[model samples]
Target chain A: MTSHPPAGTPSGIVLEHVTKRFGRTEVLTDISAVLPPGRIYGLLGANGVGKTTLMSLVCNHTFRSGGTVLIDGEDPAENPVVLGRTCFIREDQPYNDAFKVRDVLSAVSWFYPDWDAALAERLADRFHLPHRTTCKKLSRGQRSALAIVISLASRAAYTFLDEPYLGLDPSARGIFYDELLLAYSEHPRTIVMSTHLIDEAAGLLEEVLVLHEGRIVLRADADEARTSAFVARGLDSAVTALVGHREVLSERRLGSILSVTVRGARTADDESRARAANIALEAASLQELVAAIGIGGIGGVDTESFTTQRTSR
Target chain B: MTYARRSLRLYLANRSYVTLIPGGILVIMLAMSLVIGVAIGMATEFPLSAQIQEGMRENNGGAVYSIPGFLISLGALAVNRNFAMALAFGSTRRHFWLGTLMGFGLTSGATAASAVVLLALEKATNHWFFGVYAFDVAALGKGDYVLTFASVFVLAVLSLALGALFGTAYRAFGTKGALLTGLAAAVLVVAVTLLSASNKEIVGSWLGALGVWAAVVVAAIAAAISIAGSYAANRLARL
Candidate 1:
């Protein structure tokens, strides 16, 4: 039972030459991109790849070591007007030990102008959050649920969720997906969510941004990303012949059976060629693309072909 | 202004701690004085010495106890996890810092007011009718109340500001740096205490010479620490 805001005030985020370094460790290096408004942008990446750091910089939760961040055309740092329209709920959000679940909801209501108490209550009930329970006493899943409730109920124009489903079970995750889409449909806003459950969350994303080793490797339409590449398997000669000159993201061989993940769209001609060569053509899932991209085996393929918008800015 | 309003609400939410802890301490001290005075009154009485009688007549207690209220406020402000969460929920660092300052300001004000009220009560009741003082220490009665309040208020504010500065340093520099900073502060405090103890006559003479103006010096210290604290919070704090 998801409720939406009466009116929308969406905001877009722009990062220009953003670089973040902690002490001597450079986390995000000169990464730049424009995340457009009123869409669900998935921030996909493996561990320690600066996905969380990038989100922190855009939300002004952490200061950027270099470059500039503009939220709705204004800097978010110390700017209350811009900050009021943004919410960044992280996986390990530290709530005061003394605060109860109800206290957190009450406090957040004051921070976001468009906050919906009714929606928060509904989400809390659905998530089985005990209003009287202190935040420190909550289970891991309950903590995640509380974070989700805050992110959705705040109704901020620019919402960033860094692994908002860390401890959520499949059923709770399903609720998150359902409620997310329902809320977005009724009150559209820009939402950037980072998650490791790629295939499960792929359907909810309008656009996908894949980060590998602190750099955005691919930024493409979610659907297109799913079909961006395909697996070719058959005899070694046939598979090799079919995958020639194309980027091979990954390759595996067993005896005479050869399989390779090629980077390109699946066309009728390619399908016919695979058929004639007695090869199997299987479309690569977004999960596989993420896995392949993270491991640095794009098969010498031009990433521009997969991404609708590149992050060379 | 909206952020200001947000911070105000945040400050208000934690109002109980600002009032209760100091108020409770004052009550407990008053009760202890009453119990001790009654037990002594029941004991066998001999001819008391002039100095002992004077001591009993002017005895004041718990004047310094209310200072911990600053640490209570600091515990809420410094090293507090809620500030980080508040930022994630959409508060700017400026808002959090301002809200904390407002909260500490109110805490100090309430503590000072409480001290004044207790002082008046002690004076009216002749030190709780048992020759004991719970708030008007050093026989500094109605005429000196304002100076006493100012001194207490300054110390309270300084403690709160130091807490904020320490918390910011901890967040910006991690646990090791925070520990080192804490150690440095502790060492500095210990060194000052030892120096003052070793030069008690000089320190006492100097303090006596300053008279009520000593509170003014403390006020300046408070102001400087608070300004530095706000700067640290605004520039160095991270979520």
Candidate 2:
């Protein structure tokens, strides 16, 4: 079953000063961003940093404490027309106890205005999900695969996938990536995906939003984000000297050697200085960047002593 | 498809839960009642019609409880499972609630219609030709088809509404909230019962004036209250 196509061009999602709190524990605070239509965006953040909460709030699965969420220039909360354009399946999406895989597929097909039965069947076959088996009996990977099939087949205008590849094997994950790209190519729409496998999904994202401690710390194009920070590795004193006054994200020392993740792109002068100081400068990967920003707070410069106590050999 | 229609379809998809299982239970209960009635008739060798009439008069009509029991559980499961699934599939809470109300009405109507059919059959068969008196018992409107339909329909609606209320409460406030709500309801019921007992003459006269419709009116009012409470709780609920 399907309905009429959405009229006019998509206006995309706009969040303004969004705040969420659960009994005084603020989950998302002052989070604001503009996600233009028809692009794949990666929502990156550490565990419990409100990556899931943000997605839920956008999809209106959970109500926001404050701020406005507009989807296609309309509020999504309890608006069927607006919600119909969205699809969000949680990592542990609940299913009826008696619902078999086929039952779930059949039930969900009715809600999405553009549900593709053929695509659903094909994806289910690819995932090898047994139609007769109840969802409670499905394995973790199989459950994830089921969620993926619904998300892809629904073909909603704005699809949000939160840790969609939780328990899938490497081969299955590969299939997911291939299918996701294939689906996106075939039908261009806004997709916001949250995943811990940053580098693996980096190629698919046009923009990356790094959320840290209930706030958006960085939002930039994927290419720009890759060079947003750099790592300096060499002797402690030399690396320290090269780092200078630049904000340090994280630091680690093995014996006398020290490596520090510094914010900002490496300049030509800084590179030459690093060469002279016998320190290697490398552009931090997306994974490294997320870890640094998430683990070490934004502009969290290390001021502790770098001296390593020598042990008796 | 409209969201409410889609949600209704999804909720009613499980025929085994909404119809077959409860229907099967009713049949089993009727069969048991028939067997016991026949055995008593054969062992006593008394006037079968008089014995059956006496049995029917004394019968508490516990068999009718099965349908409402199943419906109540179905309503709760719908909130716990179907509500989340519908939202995931992009359904609004308002639409889900609308769909659920439609589902409750349809299920209750169907069950009531089935009860009416059973009562008609019992009458036509002259109590299954053995004076079983299962569907014709005093608890189910004393063999009155219209009264049975009204009573069963009201009971089913009330049961489903109460179940949705408790389920929504659980969703909005967790287990502790649900427990507190249940406790509060119990206290209210006890208090009402005590007050009614204290003013038995007045309460009895009022109920007698309304006759059979009193129970129906009371159940309908409770159902309405439950529906309102469930909607409020649903508004505050999160997936």
Candidate 3:
């Protein structure tokens, strides 16, 4: 179900040095950033890098070990006024075993002041979920579809979806993407989503935040992030000469040919220079950039020539 | 909707099974009681006299039948997975705790009212003509309709609050903490029973005194436990 957001500008979530730990294991460390209002932010990271933990911390689902987390510029822990405007749907979120699909929709409609029942009904029909089916009896894909329906119908100002596509088929995922964008267009709000389907969801993101080993290694506009680095292929001497002093993200050699992905803007002059030097330059896609970054720090060999940038606070 | 109102709806929705089980039990108890009443009427020729004789000897009938109702409510509130889901749905801890108390209060009130009606019917019909005292316990009724109703109401409310408290304790401490707490409670009970064993006369006298005001005492204690349980659940519960 899709409807317009509440009447007024939805406030954004601001995290100032947020830190979370489970016992001695730190999950998120010194995370500082301002997630602007009414934009789709892709919280991207490899598994176990604290993407889910970060979403939980933002909603105060779990207590933070240290630092400040302000939702709409106020503390959310036990604050009904602030929490009432937020909705968090976890991947493994549990529903009452006794509740049928209809029961869940009714319950959410009561809790969410802006809940749209018509939209929920439409979503249920589209997802082919039987209203009489008990929550405990739902299949994995059906459960994910139900979650999406609630999140969409709630029209919550700040919505967090962690791995929202866990068990969906390709067609179902496509339906999700289309419905998600349609919902956003109908009712704009801040939506933070975490998923491993980077290439599939890349086009839907306006900005990207990459977390690695409890630390945010990169944050930039999605398009800018894709264009932040480029790859050059040529004879070893020519490629080496062109890559001089630049940050090399990754490199491989095949006989006499050398291929290197380097960081920095690709200017027209650089492109001409590379051509003159018999080098072929190609822009790295967002997926390739994320993959390279993820592979960059293992044993320190992958990123030997790359200089990583932490662009946002 | 107000937070309390929304959360109260959630509480009711999650625990609606409380209503179903009691309703089902009431029907079954009525059907069985009727069958026995008819059989006794045919066998004894005077069912009321047999009922009185049975009541005089045992001093009980079906009054404690609602015990399962209390236990059901307790289990529902204690391990409700929906509590976590409620938080995800944007309910504040305050709303959840308060809503829980309100839900149990209303549900228990209705259950207690039903017990009062059954007790009145049993006493009026001379143990329903089968000498079955389904709702006539000596401590609760003592042949006084109002007193019995009041006692049952008080106990019903207390049962619900105690259940909520147990649930909150389990939620805060998880399985291991719940086990340790259970062990500690068992030890305390054993110790108290042993200590009181040597002073049976004193304990009996004190109990007799307590019996006069048991309803009030239990109600007050239940209220206190409900509040403390809510506070602890609010502070310690994690998603």
TM-score of each: 0.87, 0.92, 0.85
- In the predicted model 2, the residue pairs found to clash are none
State in Å the error of residue B135, model 2: 1.2
Q: Write the per-residue lDDT of candidate 3 for residues A1-313, one digit (tens) a residue.
A: 1122343345587777789999899998887777879999998878899998998887777889998877777778888888888889889888887789999999999888789888888888888888999988999989989999999899998888888888889988998899899999999989999988888998899988887777677788888788888988999998888778777766779999998777777889889999798899999876767666676642222121224542211
lDDT of 1 by residue, B84-174 (tens): 7768877877777777677677777776777788778877876666565456655333236886677666656776677666677667666
Clashing pairs in 1: A248-A299, B61-B133
**Which consecutive 10 residues in model 3 chain A have the weakest lDDT in total?**
A297-306
Give one clash count per candidate, in the order shown: 2, 0, 9
By summed lDDT, the worst window of 10 consecutive residues in model 1 chain B runs over: B44-53
Docking class of 3: medium
- C-alpha lDDT values of all predictions: 0.75, 0.84, 0.74
Candidate 1 root-mean-square deviation in Å: 5.5
TM-score, candidate 2, chain B alone:
0.92
User: A-chain TM-score in candidate 2?
Assistant: 0.90
Candidate 3: TM-score of chain A is 0.85
Indicate the docking level reached by candidate 2.
Answer: high
DockQ values for all predictions?
0.75, 0.85, 0.75
Candidate 1 Cα deviation (angstroms), residue B3: 1.2
Residue-wise lDDT of candidate 1 within A20-122, one digit each (tens)?
8888998887676777799999999888888889988888888899988887777788888788888888888888777899998999998887898998999
Query: What's the lDDT of the predicted structure labeled candidate 3?
Result: 0.74
